[model samples]
Target: MIHSVLEFLTDELNTFIKLKVGDPTTTRIYLSGVTNEAGIAIPDQSLGISLINIEEERVNKDQQNRFVNAVGKVEKRNPEIRLNLYVLITANFQNKNPNNSSDDYVEGLKQLSYAISFFQSKNVFTPENSPGLGSFDPNLQKIVVELYSYSFEQLYNFWSVVGAKYLPSVLYKIKTISIQENAVLEQGEPIEQIFTQSQHKS
Candidate 1:
């Protein structure tokens, strides 16, 4: 499920870049990790989408999430596993020198700005919103993209943990990725009003 969502997003972003720069093959989006076939971080210019964190939607635990079966029977299941995906999109520019005339690294910042605008313009995505996906993932119903702000300390800590120098990057919180399995836990009877004693001692 995660793979499908990410793949869809990657394709959409690639399309966006192609349209913006008027060159379909200019840039590429990676699934994070600056690795090659041999698994090594190489300096390259492209967009990297990495999943930084995952959190279950505990607030929806009480809601009964379910799906209709083929036999026309509504099957009640446990609450759907709603997840918030903290995705980091990093622009890896080859040249890091700011003073150089031909610095792709600074170019990375420009690319990052482009991405920010793209998301700002289209913050919400659904199967209907994105027609280019063709046969969109069935499990993916909808997704909301939101910009995540971080403190200076948090930003420094992230790079430190990644064990790499800072790259022009932005973080987005992709919210409410729901995955529901049609597995019924238990059937429950309907609830009725309960009898209670009066506090005034009637």
Candidate 2:
């Protein structure tokens, strides 16, 4: 499910970038903070998306449904593991410009602005908006992407925790993804309602 979600985002964002850059092959997206098993850097230099955090969603617990079979056999399943995902999208363009003016920082800011607008304009991804998403993971009903803001102190700490120097990046939260195990914890007969006819008083 995680892979599918990321794949969907990667395709959506990169497709936009491809149109903007007028190339589909070169301008691509990569999963950020990734390295080969041999400790070698992977090929990148496009928009990079990296998962930063995941939190369980407690609100969906009430949505789970108890099952009663045809024979009035009752069964109960645990609530789904609802979760929210936080990922960082960083412009992976080269830091150096052709003019040799060291405008990489400026380029990053510009790209970040563009990315923010793209999300703002269309923040919802679902079967209706993006059919490919459901193909990637059928269980994915919808994905709501929202920008997350951080204070200066928090940003500094976040970068420190990432163990990398800060780059031009944006934080987005993908929310309400859930997973339910099919195991039935309990099974029993459904309660029967009995109606007794009152005898006429004589």
TM-score of each: 0.77, 0.81
Off by more than 4 A, model 2? 34-44, 63-65, 69-72, 94-103, 194-202
* Residue-wise C-alpha lDDT for candidate 2, range 1-202, written one tens digit per residue: 8878888888888778677657768755676563334431223345578887898977646665678877788989876787899988876545545564323556556656767777898899879888788788888889999999878898898877656556667899989787876688899887789788888888
> Least lDDT summed over 10 consecutive residues: which range in candidate 2?
34-43
Local distance difference test values of all predictions, in order: 0.74, 0.74
Residue 44's C-alpha lDDT in candidate 2?
A: 33
**Candidate 1, residues 27-111: lDDT per residue as tens digits?**
5667766444553253366778888889887874658555466665555787768888988888877665656643576667876
Task: Please tell me which predicted candidate would have the highest TM-score against the true structure.
Answer: 2
Compute the lDDT for candidate 2.
Answer: 0.74
